[model samples]
Target: MPPSPTPTGPRIKSPETLIAESGADLEGHGLKRTMGLFQLVCFGVGAIVGTGIFVGLSDTVAEAGPAVIVSFVLAAITCVFTAFSFAELGGAIPVSGSSYSFAYAALGERVAFLVGWCLLLEYGISVSAVAVGWSQYLNELLDSVFGVQLPTALSAGPADGGVINLPAVVVMAMAAALLVRGIRESARATAFMAVLKIGILLAFCAIAFSAFQEGNLTPFLKEGAGGITSGASLAFFSYIGFDAVTTAGEEVKNPRRNIPLAIMICIGLVTLLYCAVAVAAIGALGADAVGDKPAALSLVVDQVTDSTVGGGIVAFGAVVAIASVVLAVMYGQTRILMSMSRDGLIPRVFERVSPKTSTPVRGTLIVASVFAVPAAFSSLDVVVNLTTIGTLATMVVVNIAVVALRRSRPDLKRSFRVPLYPLSPVLGVGFCMYLIWGTGWTTWVQFAVFLVVGALVYAFYGRRNSRLGAAQAQAA
Candidate 1:
């Protein structure tokens, strides 16, 4: 039986209850624990390695010039700090909700609802951003391989002077279909794609580095401090998926051990690849050529090798990379909603798992459909900035939640702990704030509006129907 709502103040779920219920959910007909450490890392890498690298780099490079390499490093530093906090909480709670579950256990229901809302902006919007990037690469691949390209009407959105971005919508639908099949199948596909994309990126670096010139990197900081900070803000988008690994807590084998380890490993591995690729791209083509090229990497490869074959290979890899991002990130989004729905914060439909597939099919489709519309109409930059702001907001809460959990649940056993404890989390919060500060004023306004809307939604619907409030009412 479900509890009926009653007015109640803020409430936090105990770590013990959160862990126990999560375990039960996994044991019963909920999500299956099929992912191991390898698949887990692959999932993270797949999520983090897309869009920002293969497509958004043009803007990032344009923002920071050759010094975009420095922007990547700065963004990685911020992610590393926050990733530590996530590693600690994820290992302890091991829930499908990721940061939202962490907040519920440490920050109470209202804050948790908002964090979940921020995640909607993060993962949901990111699906559109990644899909938009995938469409560009798809066009690149076709033009290289078959000497034909998707017409602007079909490939670009209204923001890009096209009626609709059909390729973006098509790719989003494809990823959603794969997700509805099952988690095991999705993880396997992501892992294969993860490996293929990494190989392709490395090959791109090898070819590009051959033509690397010292002169190309001479005026690295042409855009100055403002550019680096703004570029870092954009670059932070690249690391969005690392935390998605933690969202798989319920689906991963031995959550305590694998979750933390996978997160740390994913961040370290991706930071290296991003920096190397940025350097190779800038060095080969110079910052001027790199700027605003939708398929910058493929263009770099083409110029370096003076052949479309080299460009074709990199384009193919990007298509695989961005597609995997849509799959993995959408999976994370559905799980977050499922956690919320189970708490009676949203409709129960989101929490229901299919008897046949053991996956939240309805929730997955709902998320994909809602997000695909944005992919069809909005530009890539618009969705990417929205995703970055939303992501940074959730991470700030996650960092604070880690500190609160440490103080409140001193006895809770954690497989991992953020090194330096308070300092690490504080730095995590600071770094996240710094990136958020670098964002354009317009994005901040949008984020403010988003928060206002989220507050209203929670107040009108989430607050009145919250499962925690019902539990408290019963206890009283």
Candidate 2:
């Protein structure tokens, strides 16, 4: 008989190790814990309310009609399950790499490396997609406000009959500069943008609610389960950045107390905003009209109000919100790469911190370069689909890790245990799988290719260079 498998690793980091590696004391790294719960919520909100709302909402409406409201609620339910798991793991680990670090401490080094690689698709590509979408709204706002527009070749993708998206590239470069400066500076800028974006969205809700017509919702559930599932899949993208709250674990004060609360708060607030916005959009213009094009929110506002101001405001919100998303997601990407590099899962260049700014300057540059090229050339649809697949896959791992850790390390203290234990995680996993299944064959092919490439990198380099492997070797 085969020997029983040894449990992989501690589901929670040993308290001694956590204290040694991440105590309150500054270890001369020049890193400071300046982020409060409010700032972290802003980070989550900034990241969550981006191009997904600006562009993807229309697609969801197109798929499920007014029943898209149900889709948003379903998607939020799915996210809440994983968010609880993330809260538990994030509070237990209190690390900077979010799922990548949580998986490493719990699952083992190989899984951790794979999660980090998957995050390349999640954060890196999502930033590019958000940037591309931001460019469109920026152009629209510019045209509406100034009666000037960018050349088609400079404002759109090749698929959209443009040579490059110059505005997207510019937005990314600006964000990269802020990121390289320092986290506090980035947080301040993000907070400002977050406020602007949220205000605009609230304004939209107020105007849309006043114009709401119940007759437009008559054809609710017009699409069936398949359509609701597809709509749920599309709506999932809007919830992407709530995990940003977890990524700030290292910098958060009293992480065990605050991290979970921030995650829950962010998710609740964002869900409320999304549900309100969706209800208003559908009630005013109906679902069929929303999925017509990229700037669907702006279009709906224009159609409902009979003036350009409503559309212009929504467009302006899109520009600010997408800018914030690019900043936050790219920030998360660089930090994750930094953690992986420090663990020797990837190249050491990404681990290098700038003495002047004390940020992962090299990692920021690398991430900016990757995102810049894509935003400058690729289609938004390609980037969005790829990002959605990667994020859903990672969330599935987090759900499984939560359950696996419970069984493996029953003694570990959890400040924020996932409610319903096994059931919640199971539901999280099932929902994530359902969405992954809905991403279609084309996305599956892309995801498979990515996995193959990741496996090769791990086998060739990550296995040998991993910090856990080095630690074990030393012990031997």
Candidate 3:
């Protein structure tokens, strides 16, 4: 066999170097530590409990019938395993890039760039998908309260046979404005919205269960095991943002303690709420009635009570919930880019923190503008599936990073550790891979193409411009 080529520069960045550099950044141009434990947990909840619960239930029910509840549980189990991996890394590294930083410190610079690339797909596209859902619920609210709604051309994207999704664009702009204001302001707003949405969902559960019938749950597994797996794949989208808590590592108070605690608490609270809502929805009305409906939650209340009042409340809540998601997810995306930019993998513009607002103003506006086009034009199904697969891919890297970091750097300070050590992270990888397998072939092709583009970008720009690689060259 031929020998492998050996010309190379810096690869792995030590965890100590990462920690020291982050400290230096914080003392200079880095984000402020404005978030406490409660705000951190609320941010996770705000990001996780949006479009998937409010608008996605109909599709999930269509796939699994009353067994959709099982799908929720399956997906929650997957998240719990991965959340542990994230908790350990988030505490030990405690950087704004989250998994990307973890990968750089353990895997290498090339792996870190790809992780950040996948994250752009996960966070940016998720905001667009949620905004599209927001437009649907907005129409419901308008029709309920004012007896009028936007024309199809104005409310829906081109994929849905409309001129433009005006409401989607509007909501994205709103989130961008809030993010550019400051992280503290954004965290406060998310906390309030998080509390409001939780109350709204709980209210929905009470109303839905009042109309529950045991008969409605008969023949729960509508399509057998395949249905549960497929529905579980879709349900995975609901948990995409729990790790957004980690992206706030630089902007959080006592991050080593708070980040891990917030992740566990957020996942537990969201799981219980998701399962409860799924059961209440299915038990109230048979799967057939709930499937394939726009504004499904509001529609369910409208039918069960023969009153628009209940429907109106749910519709209004959906608006607030989805808007909060755009805000929180957008915040995570900017921070991820900030870390990547500082490493010289991407443009330097993203790392510029506005002293006036203590946030990445340029990055926030650019992200909002770039992603808004898709919110105004793309299909929701394609966007959702793409985002789900991208998120799962990034999480797989995170789990592997946990195990890799453990073997490579035992001396790093960790406020939290995966309870079962390798077992937890190994299971986390397995579950993420299973969900990735359940997605359709088209999404796989799309994701493959995305990775290819990322590799090309790194080959042409990232590898040559990387700060660590340049430093290594100077030392040599």
Task: Per model, state how many residue pairs clash.
Answer: 0, 0, 0
Model 3 worst lDDT window (10 residues):
1-10
By the TM-score metric, which is better: model 2 or model 3? Answer: 3
Reference-based lDDT, each prediction:
0.90, 0.83, 0.89
Clashing pairs in 1: none
State the lDDT at 241 in candidate 2. 81
Model 3, CA-based lDDT? 0.89
| lDDT score at residue 234, model 2, on the 0-100 scale | 88
Candidate 1 global lDDT: 0.90
lDDT of 2 by residue, 19-87 (tens): 345432222463467888778888888889998888888888888888888889988998999999999
Q: Rank the candidates by lDDT, best first.
A: 1, 3, 2
Model 2, residue 200: distance off in Å is 1.0
lDDT score, residue 227, model 3? 90
* lDDT tens per residue, model 3, 1-476: 11212236347777667666665343266678999999999999999999999998888888888999999999998999999999999999888888899889778999999999999888998899999999999999999888899999988887898989999999999999999999889999999999999999999999999999999998977789999988999998888899999999888999999999999999999999988888888888888888869588998788888999899999999999999999999999998998888888999898888878888899999999999999998867868888888999888999999888888777778899999888998999999999998888999999999999999999999989988888777766
Which pairs in model 3 have colliding backbones? Answer: none
- Name the runs in model 3 displaced over 4 angstroms: 1-10, 24-27
